[model samples]
Target: MDLTYSAQDDAFRGEVRDWLEDSLSGDFAGLRGRGGPGREHEAYEERLAWDRHLAASGWTCLGWPPEHGGRGLGLLQQVIFHEEYAKADAPARVNHLGEELLGPTLIAFGTQEQRDRFLPRIVAVEELWCQGYSEPGAGSDLASVSTRARLEDDTWVIDGQKVWTSLAHLSDWCFVLARTEPGSTRHAGLSYLLVPMDQDGVEVRPIEQLTGTSEFNEVFFDGARTEASLVVGEPGDGWKVAMATLGFERGVSTIGQQIGFARELDAVVELARRNGAIEDPAIQDRVTRAHMGLEVMRLNALRTLAGSGTGSQGPEASIAKLLWGSWHRGLGELAMEVAGGPSLTAQGPPYDLDPFQRLFLFSRADTLYGGSNEIQRTIISERVLGLPREQKA
Candidate 1:
């Protein structure tokens, strides 16, 4: 409940703010506001270089332990860093899957060899990683994943399709969930394997969105191979490890996402005023609700991090997802309303959209991806509220 920052916290925030303001200039100046949610395709090569720059400055994995090549920042300090980074309008990061998801999972569940092999690369931004959990049939219902992998000759051969994989085309490695035990169903008999994406058997086809951008991709793993030792936890324990990774998905970096959301809200408000849409009472009410929702989200996320401490998430994580997803989607509606008829048409050329247009289009998927709102409600009901699971037919 202590929302106030200590003097040390204030100093840390100032340090973060100063570093970002200074470093995001010169050669990195163009990256100030590039590579955000719907704009990941912007200046990607430059952003990769920016990631390495962050790694070199020891800013890649601020929440990780010191032994793992991180700043070992506390929860409050981590929040401050993310807030400052977003406030500075620093470029959206490229190595988040590796730094935020895989690094922590490796530290927590990976073997010594796995940690030694992968943790340093993650810290140094030497290799990028992607999540391979969702499949053609198992986007949110992970228990039904159809991807299968078999162990043979000290390697696991994987065969399946993973859809909507973010950055799969650019990633060096993928932490995949596949069925290892034949005839197993639901959450059982699955293995979490770290497979390389460069092999010939792997194929990545970018999935173009309504925004005419392809930040997501369809990855085909046809006999994709990885060392048997690459599995994070024991075989057939992917349910546990994968769920743990889902928990990590809602870690401290979410504060940075909220800051970004705040920026988006500001943009929408500015658009309303510019277009004179603010005169509409309904538009004004929606704008007010969006602002209030952002505050509530930040508070809820802070409370979650306080109790959960950057580790695996509790049921509260579902609430966070639901809240932010709906809020962003609503903002998209508001943006469209503010833009009026102008929002319906592309700015120019072969399917190009301005920022507000892109936001409106991309936000449509907000409620669908990363555990859909419906699935989040199910989690909240069964896990958080202790409701009985609906009987399956």
Candidate 2:
């Protein structure tokens, strides 16, 4: 596949770079410090402002259809925009679930009314969203979710708990998966719904981590209610609709993240150089491995995008996710090693800050979230290698 950028793509990249350099100003380095844990309030506000700026310029939803609030750019332009945004070290808008997963799913499956109501809000950064999928008992085994949604008079009453919900405390709404039917098979009884977060009967409690911050939440829904019109697709068809959301999550969203990770890898190499670790053969080897991993991921993203039009589900997407997570964790670990003692502490002078330390702490969740590496391996084996499915009792 031709991964080369055309003249127009190059021009778009340059424009995005210039705009970000001019518009995105706040202590991004400080925001980077606030990256790990609970309620980086200032960081969140800055990111929201940035999102609004991009939305006003029609840059926030670059990949969306023009009939929606986007510029309707192609995949190449989207890639270029992300690359430039990473280079600028801009704080990414905190509405990834809305922009990446829910918006796309709505475009593909929602009624025109749903699209008109939700898509514009997402583009304008007026409504923040979180994915309400994982539960205490169900994460990688997503189809095993037990959150129940019962049809009432003109509404669906939802009751269950969703754990590991990122940014749920700050989200305005959630796109959730709930069991609409009991006793059905794991995948068949599920349904997807859009529920407002601030309503009564919904409680969000933060889960503090080892990093001494809480970026995720335990969202408890006790008789949460939404109109029947809020149901995405048909009831009992949520398994299929959920796949569309997860496919975008695992495919396109991962590509955007890999771009950011590549930049962080570069920062690691520079850190090694500054710390006088570049001369060590071992350090050099680690850096080389990180570079190779980034290249593989980039190529895989390109291949996936190229074959996207043909409706092909290649193994490269899983490979990309697996490799990116592992490589990022490695880079984070290596950064700490190169930084030596100072990296152990989370606080220090600006230039003396240990990026690796923070990254290492955060990277621990990479393999666990968004379908673990083990799960991806299973997908590759069954779907790509033509292996027999493991029989269940």
The model with the greatest lDDT is 1
Model 2 regions more than 4 Å off = 25-42, 251-255, 310-316, 346-353
What residue pairs clash in candidate 2, if any at all? Answer: 38-214
Q: In candidate 1, which residue pairs clash?
A: none
- Count steric clashes of candidate 2: 1
Clashes of each: 0, 1
Worst 10 contiguous positions by lDDT, candidate 2 = 32-41
Worst 10 residues of 1 by lDDT: 307-316
The Cα local distance difference test for each model comes to 0.90, 0.79
User: Model 1 over residues 111-196: C-alpha lDDT tens digits?
Assistant: 99998899999998899998898888899888999999999989999999999999998899999999999999998999999999
Scored by Cα lDDT, where does model 1 land? 0.90
TM-score (C-alpha) between model 2 and the true structure: 0.92
Task: Please write out the lDDT profile of model 2 over residues 1-393, one tens digit for every residue.
Answer: 887777887888889888877675554344432332223444678677667777887777777888987777787777777777666666656877898889988998899999999999999989999999999999988988999999998998999999999899999999999999878769998899999999898999998765556778999999999888998999999988888887677554455567678777778788878888888999999888888878888787778776785222345467667877777778778888888788766574542334566678778887888779988888788877889986768
